[model samples]
Every structure is written in C-alpha cells, then in structure tokens.
Target: MSFDGRLLSGISVLAAVVQSRNFARAADVLGITASGVSRAIGRLEERVGVRLLDRTTRSMVLTDEGRLFYEQVAPLLFGIEEAAVSASGAGGVARGRLRVDIDPYFLRSQLSGRLGGFLRAHPELTLELVTRDHVGDLVTDGIDVAVRFGEPVVASAIARKLMETRVLTVASPGYLKKHGRPVHPSDIAGHHCIQFFDPVTRRPFDWEFHRGRKVLPVATLSRLYVSDVGTMVNECLAGTGIAQVLAIRIQPLLESGRLIDLFPDWSGETFPLYALYPSRNHQPAKVRAFVDFVSKVIREPPAHR
Candidate 1:
C-alpha cells in the first residue's frame, strides 16, 4: 500500500483503538465489528511493516512504535480539527461534544440541577457526563475534561482548583434521638458508624476529627460498610448510623431536618476539588468553554437550598 493510504488507515484505527481501549469498543465507535477492527489493525501493521500493538485476550497495549506514531500524529489530527473549527467559525460558538468525568456523589449533589443553565448558555453544545468513582485517563479515554477531588497526580494534566470540600460527621435526627449524640471522638467507638470502603486500598476509611490545634483519628466501629457515598448518605438518613461524608453531599438532608451534624465543632481535613484536562496549550474550544463554565459554577454559591 502507498504511504498516504497506510497513514490514513493507521491514524483512523489508532484513534479508534486509543479512544475505545478495546477492539469491541472500537468496533462499536466506528460502526464496525470487532473482527473488522482487528482486520483494519492487521492491515495497518502490514502496511507499516511493523507491529503496532501488543494484544492479549484481556487487554491491548501499544508498542513503542505505536506510542511514537500516536504522539506524532495526535497533534496533527488535533491541528486539523482546530483548522476546521476556525474555517467554519465554530471557535466563536460553543458547539460539538463536551465529554466530562465526575464523581457520582459530587455530580448528584452539586452539578445535577445546575447543568441546565450551562446547557442553556451553550445551546449548540452536546454534553456527556460520565459519573464514575474510578479516575479516568483524559487522553486515551478521549475525555475533554474532568471534575475530580484532590490534586492531579499526573504531571501531564493541567488542574485548576475549583473548591475545597469539607468533611462532616452526620447522622439522621431520629438516629441521634434514639442513640444519643456522641460528645467526643472516643464516644464514636460505641456507636454504629457507617464506613466507606476504599476500592483501591481495600480498607474502610476512619473518621477524622480536629480538636483545637490537634487532629484526632476516630477508629470507625463499622457495622455497615458501603462503597457508594450516595448509599452511605441514604443509610444515614434512614437512621442506620453516623456517617462521615462530604458536607455538600448531605446538605439537603441537613437543611430538611432529616439529618443532624454530630461533633459540629470538629472539622475534618479539607481537600481541593479540581477541574482537570490535558493541558492548556492548544486546548479544544469546546473544552475551554466547558471548563470556564464549571469554574464559574464552582465560584458561585450553591444553587440548591
């Protein structure tokens, strides 16, 4: 095959594979079968006269040659996209797909209702909100942006601090009424405490508390353990046990008198919530617009009561 033809096919197949991460997913994205994707990749490798990917039944990883090829071509492809956008005057408008990954609990409490205004602001933009507890890779996964808790560990990504999340110990009013509110951190050892299990660490999180210039760790007496923060909040609301959760997650329940804050004077460590992307240099206009909108929302007061 000619160089042009080989390059064209390679770029397409490479992009599909990188975006999807699996032959089946790539096939779905490209409107083809898994066998078709495999065939295309095979042809691409034959044309280039080099193996591009290391594949197994479970996973597909790129070879050194494939990585170099992708690094060189990705920018060119993005440049072409940017040129098209400029020629079409799309840069002046917010349009096209805006893909974002966010924590499920944060999205439910903070972004669910407020997204309407963002959509209204950019009428032409199509938004895809992916709610997952697992951290997503922005580049290979084709995510335009992500709203996540904590600082970005990846050096390649650009992170902007959106807000500081405050953790609180709370329980349903009925639970407190029945079991009595704990006056000290040691008091929690006797109470039924709802624990969030860290999936990566395989350990239940202990409750954190501050005592005037000293931080104290309250070892959780977990009667019920859960992975989902939303479920934990609901369990607390059902009068199951005291839960240590992000303050924003339980704000509605607190305001509605369904839940009461325990150890009101004690505050846990505050962590930064960040908006992250694959760096600012030559960022997509759609991504820039979405990030700016999200930053604005973060700066503003909570829309919910």
Candidate 2:
C-alpha cells in the first residue's frame, strides 16, 4: 500500500483507541468525535488490507494483526508527540502538567520544603504531586514521574539515582533522658521502640544497623507500631519511644536538639532514592525539568528537613 498524508493520523487514532480501550475515549483524547475516530481506524484498516479491531456493540478488542501493529507503532507515535512538544513555542520551554508520584516520606521531608524554587524556575509548568507509601503501576496510574525509595525495579522506565539517605536510630531528648540512651545496638532490645510497619510486606520493618563489618537487622520488640511515616515521626517526637528513621527526615529536629541520634556509629545503612520515568528516548521536557530539579534539591544536604 502506498503511504499517504492520512497514514500518521490513522495510526495515531488506532493507537489511541487501543490505549483508551474505546473509540469514544480515543476521540476525547484526539479532540474529535467518536464517529471520526471510527472512520480513521476504518480508513487505516482499508489501507493496510487487514482488520485491526474486533468490534461489538459495547466493546472492541484488537485483532492479532492490530496488536502486532500497535506494539510496533506506539513507541514511534510517542516519540513523534514528544518531539512536537520539545519543539513547540519559543526556545522549546517545558510547558505542561507533570504528574509525579512520590514516596510520602520523601515528599514530606525533601520536596515539600524545596518546591518553591522549582515552581519559580518553571512558571509555565504545573505540577500534580501524589504521595503514596507504596509504589503503584506507573502506566496504569498515568504517572509521568515517580520518586521512590529502594532500588529501581521497573524495566520499562528509566531510573535515575537521586541520592542516598542514611537510616538512623533516633530519639527525642526527653525520651532519652527518661529511658537512658542506648550505647549499643543490643541495648535497644531493652528500650521501648517505636516500629514502622512495612506497608508492602505487612510486617514491622527490621531496624538495620552496622559497626565496622558487622551489619544486621536488630529484631527489637515494640508495643507501638505505625504504618505511616508521619505517625512514626509524631510518636518519636512525643517522647513515646526511640525510632529508626531516615536521617534526612529528622535532620531539623536533630539540629534543633528536639531529637538526638542514638547509636550513631552503628546506624550507618543508607537507602537509595530513584526517579523513574517512562522513556529515555522521548522523555517530555517537563519530566526532564522536574527530575533534574528534584535531583539537585535532594542531593544538597541543606534542603532536607
């Protein structure tokens, strides 16, 4: 079949239909009527000489040929769209809404305090920041960028290391005054500890510590358990118990003498921070801007807390 001017439009509509799972939805995305979307797909199918969709009154599914075509064409379409965005307006300013899914703790500790600078730097851009303790499916959630703790696992997205925050054992001055400071990791077992439950694993996270070559998770018992990072911070602030937390989150408190680091020599483990995005090839300018800003902010020690 001879290529024509309508080829790109037809392929785009077909891809959008598959992505939206309905012609009406695809039309909404493409800023056209549902009938127009149907015609675009039909014209493309006629041109290609194969059925692209299995349609019913209520729903439609991709045929084998359509699936193969979509799989090959979707990435190219994404590249084209991104290229247009990159070249649009004067000097190609990054002007768009950035959907960011961030770790709740990281948001509270690092981003919430430093966002003003980023927003001022890119006034044309808007930000939608969603905070969650557990990472969700990025594509399904429509997340443009995700900042998460731990190693990156998503194969489809590019993960950039932002920085590492030390895992620290900390306590309020009042709590330490009352219970006495624990000099060794072993002493933690006898003290009242506030434990944070892992939302994903459904168990209290083990307190990991190290001194020299000896690194281990201290299985200390706790009567208080919290699932949320904010709650854990509050509990520690209230002088209820000693807690293991990310040092960056409690830096201000430590500096202000509201909290004191406990077993400093033993508490040396660091957790990696990562920024994940859909594609390296055609990353939106807005996504690139946000990622760069966040990396800069988190990497600076003074921005934390």
Candidate 3:
C-alpha cells in the first residue's frame, strides 16, 4: 500500500498498544474501546500484509514486525506532536501537559514550595513530574523539560544554565565529637567517611576539597556507601559519618546545629545546574512558562551568609 493510503490513526493505535503493553490500557489512553483498538490493529496488519502482534488470553505482545514498525513511526509521531504544539496559539494562558524530569532532592528542597505558585499562575496546565537521578532522553521519553545538576553531555537538547550548586562536606555534631573533625583534606583518610555512590558510574565518588589556591582529593575509608542523597543526609544526621552534599539541601540541619560543616577552610567545587529542553524555537507555552519561572527562581540572589 502507498504511504498516502496508510492510516496514521492505525499507526498511532499500534504504537499506543506497544507502549502500554495491553489492549485495554492502550484503549483507555487513546479514549477508545478495547475491541475498537483490536480492530484498528487488525486492519493495520491487513493493510501492511504482516502480523504485527502476538495476542494471548492473558496478555498482548508485540511481534518482531510490530517492534520494528513502532521504532520507525514513533519518532515521526513525536515530530508531528511537536509541530502541532508549536502551531498552537498560546495566548496568555499556558495549556496542555508539561512533562518534566528532575532530581528528587532538588525538587523536594528547592522547587516544591515554588511549584504551588507556578500551578496557580497556570491553572490550565497539567504537570507531570518524573523524579530520577539519572538523565533520560527527552524525545524518546516524551519529556518536555529536564532539570539536572552538573553539566549535561547530551548534544541533542538545548541546555540553559539554571544556577550554580554549592557543595559542602558535613557530618552530624555527634559524629564529629566522636570521630574528631578533620582539619585538612589528608586528615579525612584517618576518619570514618561516608561515600556517595554515583548511580550513573556505579562507583564511589571521590571526595573533593579546596586547600588555599589548590584543589585536593581524598580517598575515603568508607564506613557507609549510599546512592540516594536523602539517605546520605539522614545517615549524617544519625551520626553515621561525614557526607558531601549540596549546601542548600543541608542548610536547615546546619542552622539547627544537627549537622556541622567539616573543614571550614575547604570548600568543594561549584557545579552548574541546567534546564534542558528539546528545542528553543517554537517551544510550547507550558514548557516556556516553566522554563521562565524556573530561571527567575534561579536568578534570585542567594541569601546572605
């Protein structure tokens, strides 16, 4: 069959089924009945002269042909969606779904309070927040924006610097009293240190510190290793060991005297936080509004020390 004669609707239906992995679930997502969905897939297979799906009483599975078809058409569907969003008249109101990927710690500590205000400003917009430490493909994952710490290596998206993150090495006051605070970077090797395991690297992250005009690295004698920053903070609060975390995330603990900054003379490197999106041109209203709000929040001067 000619491409012009092919039904894009059938392609979309097939894609939804493959993505959702169930005919009923796909139907619910596409606002159609399960039988209707099955008919659409049947018609699609007939037109293409290929069996696209393997169906059983319990579940639906995509055949090899279906997988290949989905891979080829998903990108085209995404492009069409983007084009439609771009052509939409935004007016002064933000509408439609705004999908965002962000780190859990940053979202909870920084963005949580501000999100209420943002939602109030754009009542028509629906927010879908995905909290994860690892970065994901915005296009393939159908994410509208991503808030990430440090630098992003992905060249496909447009990355805008949101803010600079200040990191600090800290421990609970009790832990410090028991283990004795390290006066210098080299002294850390003598103490029981908390190690942060990078999820992406699957290895322990090196401890970073500053000494006068030079940078110092400390190899830790890890008593505890954790992947989540929240858990690391909790461990430090419970007097487990010293941890390196974003200063903002631990500011309240520091102020409350529950956590003490170790080696006051040394500070870790400042990492850039960025907001990445699929493209700058023809951005959707919801995405544009979110980026603007987030940027404004980041631009606000840090509180006086």
RMSD of each: 3.8, 4.4, 4.4
TM-score, candidate 1, is: 0.81
Off by over 4 Å in 3: 1-26, 35-92, 153-157, 211-213, 278-282, 301-305
- For residues 1-305, write the lDDT of model 1, one tens digit per residue: 54586668668877778767889888888898888888889988887788888998777877878766665677677777788888987766778777788888878776777788888988999999888766655666667788887667656577878788778888888898899989987799899989998755668876778756779887767779888998998888899999888776676677778888777788756768888876435778777787787666666655432
Q: Over all chains combined, what TM-score does candidate 2 have?
A: 0.79
Number of the predicted model whose lDDT against the real structure is largest: 2
lDDT of 3 by residue, 1-305 (tens): 55753579898888677655688988999999999999999999998889988998668766767656655676677667766655675444678767899888878876777888899999999888999868865644557789888788657678888777677888888898888888877888887778888788889887888756789887888868888888888988998888888876767777888988876678747778888876435556687799888777666544421
**Would you list the C-alpha lDDT of every candidate in the order shown?**
0.78, 0.80, 0.78
- Clash pairs for candidate 3: none
Q: Candidate 2: minimum summed lDDT over ten consecutive residues — where?
A: 85-94
Order of models, best TM-score first: 1, 2, 3
Any idea what lDDT model 2 has?
0.80
Top candidate (TM-score): 1
Ranking of all predicted structures according to lDDT, beginning with the best and ending with the worst: 2, 3, 1
